[model samples]
Target: MMADDIISSFPDEILCHILSFLPTKHVVATSVLSKRWKFLWRSLPFFDFHYDGDLFDYDRNNEAYSHFLHSVDSFLLSRDRDEPLHRFRLRSDSTYGHPVSIQRWITPAVSGSVRHLDLCLDWGFVMPSVVFSCKTLVVLKLTFIRVENTFSVDLPLLKILHLNNISSPEGLDLSQLLSGCPNLEDLEVKGFISTTKGKFITLPKLVRASILEDLLPLEVVKDVEVLFLDSKYQQILDFDFQNLVRLELILQLSKDWLGVLEVLEHCPKLQTLLICIYKSSFDTFLAGHEEVVWSYPQSVPACISSHLKTCSLKYYSGSIDEIQFASYIMGNAKYLRIMKICIDSESHFTFGEKLHMERELSSCMKSSDTCTLSFEYSS
Candidate 1:
């Protein structure tokens, strides 16, 4: 007869499904609504526990932290073991300062066959080894966690993996982890701090990947179709990506025109190319790079002549080397459909400088009759 009674009269399975979309804390708080909801949350397939610094009062934060920890333990302990955990997420600010307790909280989810696990922990926390061997995990994301080399990882069904701000006790052997994932499709590794040399081990089914790293040697995976790289490393002469269809390169100040050309010569199938030049100083970094000393290749790469369709250049300053590289692409890319040049808004360029750059790029002889050139200022 009442609205609340009408909604509660629905099937228990439907109510559980509705509660799955809510946070675990809210789901658990519903226990006081009615007798039917008292134990309904225990059978939920999804569990997400997040604790922020402001969630507890500074004066009595310890009591709030203890309650949060106890709530997580009780939730996991009360879960029916036979029911599969569809997803489990835990993000904490280290209020308790106990790493062993975090491991204990994660064990039951793994045993219950959690399909998705997202963990964001404070520093000094090493993930339990049981997570490495989670075969039922379809998606796993870890942030600010240390990965040890001794632990064996065998995520057979993992499809998407994101590791941000990850560290290693010993140098992390990425090859071991990549070899175990047979179905990995999308991978993103960002801000990875390692004492040993970092490597990007390739997998056959990996279609998209992004890596933002320091001056580390990159072993580019040839099988990745779409790749984004933001690196400080200058040694890119050995990069060989034959199957790359789309590429976005965020360059450092150390990268010169020759370095860009060297990478373009290797990607034979690259269709969409986006280059964002990151300038940190007013000094001409590309100067004194012997721009004219190096002989240009006699013929253009196959990708430029046939495969490359769209090319976008961000932070384009009217430098001699940049003009040369842009001219080369416009002159050689026979199949190019659109070429967009985005000028750096931060750089103070005169009206004459902007007009000259636009005229220079517009006059360049394009091999493709259908090619269109446009210019814009970066937003």
Candidate 2:
């Protein structure tokens, strides 16, 4: 069959499914394709409109956006509650005169049947309260967006929440938000660096969390594998996670060694542990200083995980304190099968540092003859 024939022969449901992935502008434009496609856009439950101003023509941007939402609202308003939104995404760089205009345009369709809502507006104003606590929403991604005050959202069915650069200055208690979302599964919290006071997002049911906030994320996500973000030292609350298996701790700065060691003491069954220590913040200092003042842990915690088998440490420096920490871990990791250390090549450590590091290697070999330690150095 010819291409046109195949396209024309497709079912209405199939056509709607295909149109769901396109932008609202393109979906609305399909009305002029043929009489059959005139009403095909309305049946499309999925609406994805990600507009980047650089690519699209600037002159007609506002007009194009206005028509798109009007069409979506008119279509949804014509439908019933039994027909809820399957997915709705609004990611744009379009600078509307007022931020509420964007909310005013899209609020109706969101009420219809949106299962997923992903909103990211950089230069826009605050979003309406209805967007935060949508009932039918199962997955929500909010970035550079602030929720309105004087309202409490109850997202009883929200399963996944990914928030970045979000803040509530007007006493927007985060514990209340998490209290409502009992079924939350995956949480990714990233905070604004310029924030003066600490911000917290509490979740009781988060199974997996990716934390990039300055403040320690203390939650009761028990029996789940935890992956920590890059930090020099962080003091976090302890949870009873006896069944924990995997852990990824990224240490880039040398702020508080004592706190981090304390955290390691609790993970009893952390089989696979990846430690990434970055040098971006200390590059200039490393060159000027003769001996690096590593924030040595005053005392190593008594907690040791006999089940830890695999470990990876990045940004490994051949320093006395570094070796000491390594020695302690290597000696204690009785069941360790493989250990990998990532070293920088440009680093010309002083003679004393090299000797200290060698002592750690010898001690490790003597203690655990069966353990395997491999060093990956980059020159």
Candidate 3:
């Protein structure tokens, strides 16, 4: 097919898919490609206005940033506000030069039309003073950004919310967010690029959640499918995951594995459990805590998922604590079948010692039927 003819034959949907992978700068530059491509980028269902200083860092005093911001504003302004946006992402590291700078795009993209909203501003500017009551939003991701007092973005139709590195999310209350999002499903608060030092936040209606760093707690949320905890704090978690199915615990062993176990008591059907217990770099935790044994519940609640058949552990060195924990699950998981222990290379276990682990696990199963315990290593 001729180049121009082939471009003309391509469907708008296909064109949008091709454009989504490129940088927004290139997407906009398509306007200069030809008349056929002028409005194609605008028809895209998703907009990721991500600014990478590493790629196009303009001098703070230069006209490039302002010009770029204006171009974004123009595109949003031209779009029909009523048109529902599927995904909208905006992020930067510089303090947004002006408060109004964010509103120029946020105000239009919001308004009960967006289904997936990702609003990230990094360290750039303070957020706009606007309450986005998105009635049709399904997934909402809010990253590092500051907001003035009295701010709320209601997502009545929201299901998944991934909050990463919230800066002074003090004014944002979990109760209001929960009550507003009556249909929320998954909530993940990852402190990847940002950290929190104040009161932890707790939300409502979420079924799966990850609490990392110093994030706040959820006063209430139920029917959870998964739970992940990664933090440096030593506080014992005291929440009840009544119907949780999968649990992932990642933290330094020095912190305390039992604190993580305490959180699992409420789970009635926890099927898959992955414990990445950093073995005190593979020493101090096992030897240091061997005498301090835990007094656990007599019966590990299997109601949440009596169907649990597989288990995996990382950083496993056949430590007494590690084996004891795994044995507790084997005893309670009446239908347990396979348990895989992956010992991290950073561990102190010898090749023969690891082989010994496999032999010991052979007899660890509770039932007459045999369960496989495969011990592996990480590079």
Candidate 4:
């Protein structure tokens, strides 16, 4: 009959849904509202717990830290066993020397069959083994953690997995981790450094992947249909992608042009291609290498002759290698519908040189009669 009573009189399921949108701390605090709202948060499917303070200060704030730990324990203890958890997120900058406490907090989420699990901890805490075998998990994200190679993973329904700044021991077998997820589609691994020798990582059903690492392994790129690669390593020409449809590459300008061309020759089904060129401080180091001679391919790749439709070159500087590559694609891409080039602002070429370069590209013998070319200067 009144505004206050309207929300309080909501059905139990609706009240839990509303509380699921709030942070775990705020949801717990709502117990003080009234007797009817006392246990409503216990059935909420989502829980997010974040502690932003320094863990080293636990001695000075022992009472506060103890209270926070007790609150987490109480919250998990109060959850309804019959209700399934949809998402669980816990982030702590410092573990405060109590890895066991963190483990205890996560055990219930795993047992409850949480669909999405996100855990971020600064200290190198060994994750519980139950996480590796979470069959109900659809998404899993871990940050600043270490994964051992001995554990077994059995995530049958997992579709998305993100591992950031993750480290592994000397004998860690990453292939074991990938093989467990049969239906995984999207995977992102950034700042991952393997201490041991390389392992062959395979994902047969993978549709998209982003790998940003110091050493980009060829095995990880083999089966992906769409890939985004940003790496310091330049030895990726040896790998082949037969089913690849789209590719986005971010690389330093000092990369070997011959190697890049070798990679392009391997993709047979590439329909869309984007290359982002960046200026690196190691230009002098790159200059020491032998120059790449402009030798046109005897026969154009199958992708260029039949499949390629959209091609973009960003930060184009009209260098010899850039011009040759662009000209080759323009001349050979029979199905090309759009070819867009963005000139670099800090390019070495003059205004007249740029105009000449554009005219040269426009006059190239295009195999695709309906192909259109567009040029613009980088802002």
* Top model number, lDDT: 1
Task: State in Å the error of residue 318, model 4.
Answer: 5.8
Residue 17, candidate 1: how far off, in angstroms? 6.6
Position 112, candidate 1: lDDT: 66
Give the local distance difference test score of model 3: 0.65
Better of 2 and 4 by TM-score: 4
**In terms of TM-score, which candidate is strongest?**
1
lDDT tens readout by residue for model 2, 140-256: 888887666625667878988887787665745455566668788886767632232324445556667666765343544554566555554344555645545776677655633
Better of 1 and 3 by TM-score: 1
> Which regions of candidate 2 deviate over 4 angstroms?
1-41, 53-83, 94-98, 192-204, 214-219, 229-239, 255-258, 280-283, 291-305, 314-379
> Which 10 successive residues of model 3 have the least lDDT summed?
192-201
The C-alpha RMSD in Å for every predicted model, in order, reads 5.1, 6.5, 5.5, 5.7
lDDT scores of the candidates, listed in order:
0.79, 0.65, 0.65, 0.78
Model 2 clash count equals 4
Clash tally, candidates in order? 0, 4, 16, 0
Model 3 — TM-score against the truth? 0.71
Residue-by-residue lDDT tens digits, candidate 4, 132-227: 788899999999887756467799999998888877664345566777888889888787765433455567788888887644466666778888
lDDT of 1 by residue, 232-345 (tens): 555645667867999898877654656666677878899999989776654466455654334567877778888999989899876665677777888899889999999977
Candidate 3 structure quality by residue, lDDT tens digits, 1-379: 7887787678888888788787676788888877888777666677777654433545653455576687777777665455456778776655435557676667666654667777777555555545346677788788876654434546667788787765544555544445566667887866533332233334455678787755354444445677786736445446666667787878575646566555555565777778776644455634646443566665555441366677788877666667777777666666777777888877666778878887777667564155666777876
* TM-score for all models, in order of appearance: 0.74, 0.68, 0.71, 0.70
Off by over 4 Å in 4: 1-40, 50-81, 92-98, 195-202, 212-221, 230-240, 284-295, 314-320, 338-379
Record all residue pairs in model 1 with backbone atoms less than 3 Å apart, i.e. clashing. Answer: none
